[model samples]
Target: MSSQWSQGEIYESYVGRWSRLVAAEFVAWLDQPAGLRWLDVGCGTGALTTAVLTQAEPSAVVGVDPSEGFVGFARGAVADERARFEVLPAAELSTDAVGGAVDVVVAGLVLNFIPDRPDALRRMREIGRTVGVYVWDYAEGMQLMRYFWEAAADVVPDDRERDEGRTFPFCNPAGLEGLFAEAGFSDIETRAIVVPTVFESFDAYWTPFLGGQGPGPAYLRSLHPNTQTAIRHLVESRLPANPDGSIELTARAWAARGTS
Candidate 1:
């Protein structure tokens, strides 16, 4: 099933919350000097844009995403006059779109979703002097989706191909670095950013999957109700839960940065 990128609130509850944590670390790692102009491509719900504004202290930022729902939600959630959001696709990114040259261009947990990555990266390079991006290590260290996909495979082996780990193999460091290099980005560097993801209860963890905003949730919604129940139960069983019923896991993202 194709992933649904709309429904900002549901996406936030499902994975945008974790995206916020990863975005903070990503911004810190970029360590760009203050007062730079930034463009946040695929800035879903302004998580990365907010991070850039708060952490990097950019002079101005323009966040762009294809989803109007996400852009509207971002505009509402982020009240800073220094930040503005637009409903535009990564492929359409340009200096004119952002109003001026950008010092830094960053995408958090979004590169893998863009249909034409090379075109998007080319645009990012043309408009900004620095480009940095991050995506979940979905094949391994993104534990939340990893556990869910494992259970999904157990329930429906034929559907194993739908797992993001399989769908987004390029989220790894080597692959990310390669993309940057191919895009003519110099001084490319890659790192892993890990953060704790503690779910208050199985419900806290499982309920988000029903939100139908991303790949795992979209897949779950595609299955029969009984099949969904089976998968959910299996996921609960396999997760390492605490005596108090909380689930603790770590999410890792591979980040890459390069000079244009």
Candidate 2:
């Protein structure tokens, strides 16, 4: 629940891979025509922005994120002349900075982290000629955090405080749709995209959290090292015992699209 998104290595290590998978799914939702211009809000590491460029082949692509390290990583990863990266928050996007109307605006797994979600959505709408947004958060009852917490609870059963991490911002599909509607997006449609988060072993599963990238990382960091280790062991033990031995985490993300 820290507002700061300064953990660059953590983000790329823990969440960035899965985030890229979700971004690819989000791009599939777009009816991206040739020569479309795209603005990627909160384009962490430029994964989604790169996806947009690959899929849409837009006339120009601009990616913005609040984290300098993430923006820097994105700049280095994506070297297309038409693609640009900036260290700016989504809430600051305006018609003035963008020059003229943008053909499309895309946000990937970003809305939940922004403090002023409504205003940010509105700004995206204002700047976009057409808006397509994708958000992936811990779905209620199906959260990956639940796996960690179920194990952590054994160690710290009294800590009801840790639950708030699971409940942060866009934890449900209805909430996501409502935010879009409130922001004046019309013809909003939402659907669930399920991805299997497979890990080779407990170390593969738990190392990412130690990096402290997103909510899971944050929660892991809050614990003592002993408690963190215990939680990891517990989660590994609870994994469905497959002969192939890959831990499969069912991750659900909500994607919404509408006209500005």
Candidate 3:
């Protein structure tokens, strides 16, 4: 099934919180000097843009996303003089939008969703001296989604075809590196940024899937109500919850960067 990208609040409940953690680590990893112009391609509610403003001290940051709802949410959520939100797609991003060539450009947890990643990366390379991106290691290290999809396959084997792990094979280091290299970037590098994803209870975790904001959740919504409950129960049973019933999982994102 095609993924849903609108509905900022629902998407935030699903993965935006986790993406914020990855974005901070990702910005720190880039280690760019302060006072530079930055572009956040597929900014998605300003997670990475906020990180850049708070961590990197960029002079200015323009966040661009295809979803008007996401851009609106970002504008309201990130109220910084240095930050601006635009309703634009990654494929259409240009230096003009960011007010000339930017010093750094980054995409957080969004490369996998772009239909033409190579072209997008090429465009990113053109707009910034340094370009970086991070995507969830959905195939393995992103434990939360891994658990959900594993349980899903057990209940409905055909659903395995819809798993992000299977769908986003290029999210890994080698694949990311290849994309950067092909985009004519130099000194390419990649690393994993794993963070804690703690839910107060199974309800906190299960409820987000019901919001139907992304692929996994959208897929879950497609099933019969009974099947959805079965998947939820199977995932809950498998989770190693704490004595207080909190569920702790780690999300790992593969981050890559290169110089233009």
lDDT of all the models against the reference?
Answer: 0.90, 0.76, 0.90
Pairs with steric clashes in candidate 2: none
lDDT by residue (1-260, candidate 3, tens digit) is 11498878998899999999999899999999999999999888889999999999889999989899898999999989999888888878788866789999899888988988899999998899999999999999999999999999999997688999999999899999999998899999999999999999999988999988888988998999899989999999999899999998999999999997
Q: Tell me how many clashing residue pairs each candidate has.
A: 0, 0, 0
What would the per-residue lDDT of candidate 2 be over residues 1-260, giving only the tens digit for each residue?
13545655667666677777877777877767879888998888888988888877799998888888888888888989999988788767997776567889988778777888889889999998777666665535345666776777787787645653445656466787888899999888888777777788767777776776566667678889898878788887887746877677776777887786
Query: How do all the candidates rank in terms of lDDT, highest first?
Result: 3, 1, 2
- Residue 259 lDDT in candidate 3: 94
Model 2 global lDDT (CA atoms, 0 to 1): 0.76
- Minimum summed lDDT over a 10-residue window in model 2 is located at 1-10
- How many backbone overlaps does candidate 3 show? 0
RMSD, candidate 1, Å? 1.3
lDDT of 1 by residue, 1-260 (tens): 12488878998988899999999999999999999999999888899999898998889999998888898999999999999998888877888888889899999888988887777888899999999999999999999999999999999999989999999889998999888888888999999999999999999999999988899998899999999999999999999999999999999999999997
Candidate 3 differs from the real structure by a C-alpha RMSD in angstroms, to one decimal, of: 1.3
Residue runs of model 3 more than 4 Å from their true location after superposition: 1-3
Q: Compared to the true structure, candidate 2 yields what TM-score?
A: 0.90
